[model samples]
Target: MKGVMASVQDVGAPREKLQALEKIEQDIAAALSSAASALQELSKDKPAQKHVDSHSTAFIKTLQEVENGLSQQISYLSQVTTSQPHEGSSYGSQKDMHMAMHRSAHVKSRLSELEKLKMEHLMQKHTGILRSYSASNDSQQPLTPHTPQQPHTPQPHQQPQQQQQQQKQTREQQAQL
Candidate 1:
């Protein structure tokens, strides 16, 4: 009876240790499950983040292309407005000359329109910059109006004509003297 009692006690001790080990294993499995769920959630968000990033990049690229096109148009208008008229070009008749003059007037008007658009674009860009700067600085100062300066371009033909007139006037004065 004494030996049987000792054997029973030894068996009970091993059963308790086995139960503890099974509990520890269950806790480890629960922790691993929680970590796996968290990783899955993060992975799901990654695709959304990538989608947003791609959209923003595309938007920026499109905006840059539009800005480049506007700049090119502005340059073309400036060139047309500053170009010298070909006065020596042979026109078959007065009607042809009149048509040429009309075309020139049309181009000038279009150039003026483009210039206004350029000015507006510049104003908007500056306003945005100023707004951002003021916001960052926490300043509430009134924004001053910015005036775009018009470049003075002298006509190529006018200078020589003016010099000739001046020489002619000098000759007349010398003769009078």
Candidate 2:
């Protein structure tokens, strides 16, 4: 009989959440750029109805705040996420190893997200930087940004499969260590 091991396989990704976040991020990012432009438009020190576009004064303020906060987080979150060291396993029961794999999967998923966000942040940073640095002659462009399927339902049996794979990989890594 083949004993179950802690599985350590890539469990795809949370597509819906990722898609939603990416969409929201794009929307917010666009809003931010538009708000910046509107700000530049408004702060022109000119008085005109055209200058006073539909963008709310309050909305602009909020976008600026969010942009700043997200910008800061992008730099920091990316760095910390990449630098995070994976903890060594405590080395115990089959159950423990199994649990560890699930936890590691969760961490991996989060790290992947953080890394992606970090990249997006960097892109945004450069976009803002270049545009600001060369507002005089920058060309017009719109920045835009994956597919994963969800299981029909959770598989309790798959848990053992994942765990067994996890155990095998863990043991191999540990042996090398």
Candidate 3:
């Protein structure tokens, strides 16, 4: 009779263990269901996220276009200033010309700085986009901005004072004639 009771107890132990495991499985299923529903809810707003991304991309593109236009204009102006013929024999006029040349140089430097800033902004924006895209794609690819090789535009050098004076004298003699 004691052996029969021991056998019964052993069977009950296994039954209890099975019940506990079944309960654990049910709980896990319930949690998964809850998570799935939450994901579905969040997915409903994905269109809004996409719309914002598109708008941001468009804005960046427009800004880039504007920067490019300004850069071209600056390049053209720098070229025109450099190509201008020298003038004036008077010390005062020479001083004014010197100041103008300095100012032109300053402008070129400022424009170059602006271009650098614009490029940096563009790179940052692209990096952000790449990060977000890679996150969505589950990719491990690194983001790198494509920096194009820009031909160095030679800066305008100041003309010699003697050459400026000679041009000025020639202009004066022609005017007198």
Q: Note the Cα lDDT for every prediction shown.
A: 0.51, 0.50, 0.50
Q: Evaluated with TM-score, which candidate comes out highest? A: 3
Local distance difference test, candidate 2: 0.50
TM-score ranking of the models: 3, 1, 2
TM-score of each: 0.28, 0.26, 0.29
Compose the digit string of candidate 2's lDDT tens values, residues 52-83.
56555545765665565444445434434565
Q: Is candidate 1 or candidate 2 better by TM-score?
A: 1
Q: Which ten residues in a row have the lowest lDDT in candidate 2?
A: 3-12
Q: Which residue ranges in model 1 land beyond 4 Å of their true spot?
A: 1-91, 139-177
Native-referenced Cα lDDT, model 3: 0.50
Model 1, range 1-177, lDDT digits (tens) per residue? 565334323333445535544554554555455445445545673545555455455545545544544444344344335552322223245557899999999999999999999999966876665565446643343433333343233356667755454444334333332
Determine which window of 10 residues in candidate 1 has minimal summed lDDT.
Answer: 84-93
Better of 2 and 3 by lDDT: 3
